[model samples]
Target: MKFTRRLFLGLAALLLGVGATMAHAANALDTIKQRKKILVAVDIGGPPYGMIDEQARQVGSDVEAARLLAQDLGVTLQIVPVSGPNRVPFLLSRKADVVMASFSITEDRKKVIDFSEPYGVVPVVIGGPASAKVASFADLSGKTIAVTRGTTSDQELTRGSKGIPSVSIVRYEDDATTNTAVATGQQDYIAAPPSTILAVKKASPSRDIASKFAMKAYPYGIGVRKNEPELKAWLDGWVKTNLKNGKLDEIYKRYFGMSLPPEVLQ
Candidate 1:
C-alpha cells in the first residue's frame, strides 16, 4: 500500500511539473519566439498601403511597417498577399500572424479580429474633374459615385449619404477600376481617401476631373488575431515609440509626400 501511494504521488508531481512548463511555453510571445517568423498579410492591390513595385518587390507603408515590426521582434517577416475581404479570415485561420493592410476599424470588424492602436488617419474625399462642381459631400447626391466595394470610403458614403435620394453608388473591384471609371466620366465622382485619390491623380494628370469630399476622418490600424494580446501590446508599443521618435513621421512623408497631420502624429 505504501509503495503504491508513493508511486501515485510521484506521477502526479511529474504531471504537474509538465503542465506548468506547458502553460508557460504556450504564452503568445513564447509561441512567437518558437516560430521565429511573423507572417504579415499585405494587400497587393492597394497602393500606399501594400503593392508591388516595378522591381516586383512588395513596397508601401504597410510593408515597411511590417518590416520594422519584425525587426523589433527579432523575427523574420514573411509577406503574405491578401485581399481586403480575406484579411480577417486569413488571420483567424492562422495563415498570417498580422495584417498590415490599411484596415479601418469598425464595429463589425471587431467581432472577428483585434486592431492595434490607430497609427494613421485618412480622410474620405470626393474627387471629380477639376472643372466639375463638387464642393461638398452633399453635392454628390443624385450623382454617380465610384468607390471600392469593401473599403471604408464605400461604408462612409453608404451611411453618411443614405438620406440623399438619387445618389447612385457604383462599386468597383479595386481602386484602379474606380479611378478609371471616374477618369472616363463613366462615374461622376470617386469617393476615396485623399491620399490615395491624390496619388491616382498625380499618376494620371490628364484625368482632369479629380477632387475630394470632406468627410469624417478614418483611422487606420494594424490587425492581429483576437486572442493575441501580447502581440497587440507589442505592436501598440512599437507604433507609439516610432511616432514619438519621429520615425513614423518620416515614413508618412516617404509614402504620402507630407508629414502626418498633428492629430495623427500624436
Candidate 2:
C-alpha cells in the first residue's frame, strides 16, 4: 500500500510538471516591469548569507545580490524573509519573484524550479573546536554534531550517516543556533559551510574551530519559476555582468574579509 501510494503521488507530480511546462509561455519580465519591484525571498537566520545587521537592517551576500539585481533592473527591491520550507512555496505562489536565499543548485530542486547560473559557491564541511578530533565523516562515529534543520547541511549529513549508527545529528532551528551549539560546546561539531564557520569565529574569536572533512559543496543560484525563460535569461546575464565588473567581489569582501575565489565567480 505504501509503495502504491508513493507511485500515485509521483505520477501526479509528473503530470503537474508537464502541465506547468506546457503552460510556461507567460512573460515574467513583463510582470516585473509592471509591478515596479522585485520581491526577493531571503533566509536571514544564517549569518553572512543573510542576517539582521547592527542597524536592524537585513544584510548579507544573498541580500546584496538581490539589491544589485533590482538596481540593474531599475526596480525597487522588496525582501521577504523565507526559510527552506517556504522558499519554493512563496516563489511558486507569486509572493516572491525570485529567491536569493543561499539556495543551492541541485538536481532534485531543478525538478521544481529553474536556477540561474551559479553566482556563488559554499564549501561544505564539518568543523568544531580543535579538541573535537573529527578528521573525516567516518571520524564522527559517535560524535554529537549540530546541523540547521531543513538545510543542505542537514540533508547531506543525514544522507552521509546511513550506516553510522553512533553518529548523533543534533538539529537546530537556525544556522546561527546550530553553529552556536558547537562554539559553546553543546555539540562536538557542526555540519556547515566554511563561510558559516568563519562567521562563528567572529563571535568567539578565541575559539580554535577548524574544518574536519568537506562534504559536497553547494553552488548558490537565483531561483525562478521553471517556465520563466525571460527572467532566467536576464538573471544569467546579470550574473555574467557582475562577475565581469567585480560587484560580486565587492559584496563578498565586505563580509568575508577577502575577495571571492575564482571558482565561485560563475
Candidate 3:
C-alpha cells in the first residue's frame, strides 16, 4: 500500500492537534496537583459572607465554605482578602484560584470569570430610618442612596433605579460604613443585601433603621477562571453534595441566622 504525500501530511497535522490538546489538559491538572493549594479570594468587609474578624482572621460564610472545599479536595486553602473591585482581576492574574465572596452572578462578570452553580440567593433591600416616609423604590427619587463601592447594590442602584430622579449615590469603603452612614442620617438610604442589613441591625439594636424595600433576588456563586471548566464542575459537584446532605443549610444558618431559603434549597 502506497501512502500519498498529502494524506501523510494530514495525518501528521491531526496527530499534532490531539497531542496539543492532551498536553494542555495535562498541564492544567499538573498545576492543581503540584500546588496542593487552592487560592480563594474573599471580601474582608462583607460580613456573614466574607469578612475579617477582630483578630484579623478571615471569618464568614464564604470563608468557612472555602475552608471546607479545601479540606474536601485535600489541599491547603490560601485565603486572599480582596475588595469587590479586585475580585475578577485576582482570578484573571492567577493570584487566586477561586472567588468565594458573595459575588452576584451577572452577565457582565460572566465575560471575565466562570461561576459555579449558585450556592445561595441574596435579596436586595433599601434601609432607612423608621421615621422616614420612604415606602418603596419610587420613594428613593431625589434622595441620597448610600452603598458599598463595587458591590451589586451599587450597580443596581446606579442602573436599575432609572425611574428615580435626582438620586444622589454615595459610595462607601465597606458595608459597615455604608450602613452606618444611613443609620446616622449621613445618607438618606442604604441599598444593601438583606443578610448584611439584618446582621448590622442586630449588631446595633439602637440604630432604629428599617429595611423598607426588597428587590429582585441575586444568586451567589463561586468564581473560577473562565477557561477552567474542570474546576467549575468540581465546585458545582461539591455544592450539590453539601446541599443534599443538609450541610449547606447548616452552614447558611450558622452565618446568616436562618436556614437556606426554599428557592435556593430547591
- Tens digit per residue, CA lDDT, model 1, 188-254: 6778877667666766777765655576677778887877777788888888888888887787789
lDDT of 2 by residue, 53-137 (tens): 8899999988898999999999999999987657888999989989998898888889999999888877678888767667667
Clashing pairs in 1: 125-213, 126-212, 126-213, 127-211, 128-209, 128-210, 128-211, 129-209, 129-210
Evaluate candidate 2 by giving its C-alpha RMSD to the native, one decimal: 9.3
Ranking by TM-score: 3, 1, 2
Which of candidates 1 and 2 is the stronger one according to TM-score? 1
Highest lDDT: give the candidate number. Answer: 2
TM-score, model 2 to reference: 0.84
TM-score of each: 0.85, 0.84, 0.86
The C-alpha lDDT values of all candidates are 0.80, 0.84, 0.80
Residue 254 lDDT in candidate 1? 92
Clash pairs (backbone) in predicted model 2: none
Candidate 1 Cα outliers beyond 4 Å, as residue runs: 1-26
Q: Which residue window of length 10 is worst by lDDT in model 2?
A: 21-30
Q: Estimate the TM-score for candidate 3.
A: 0.86
The alpha-carbon deviation from the true structure for residue 195 of candidate 2, after best TM-score superposition, in angstroms, is: 2.2
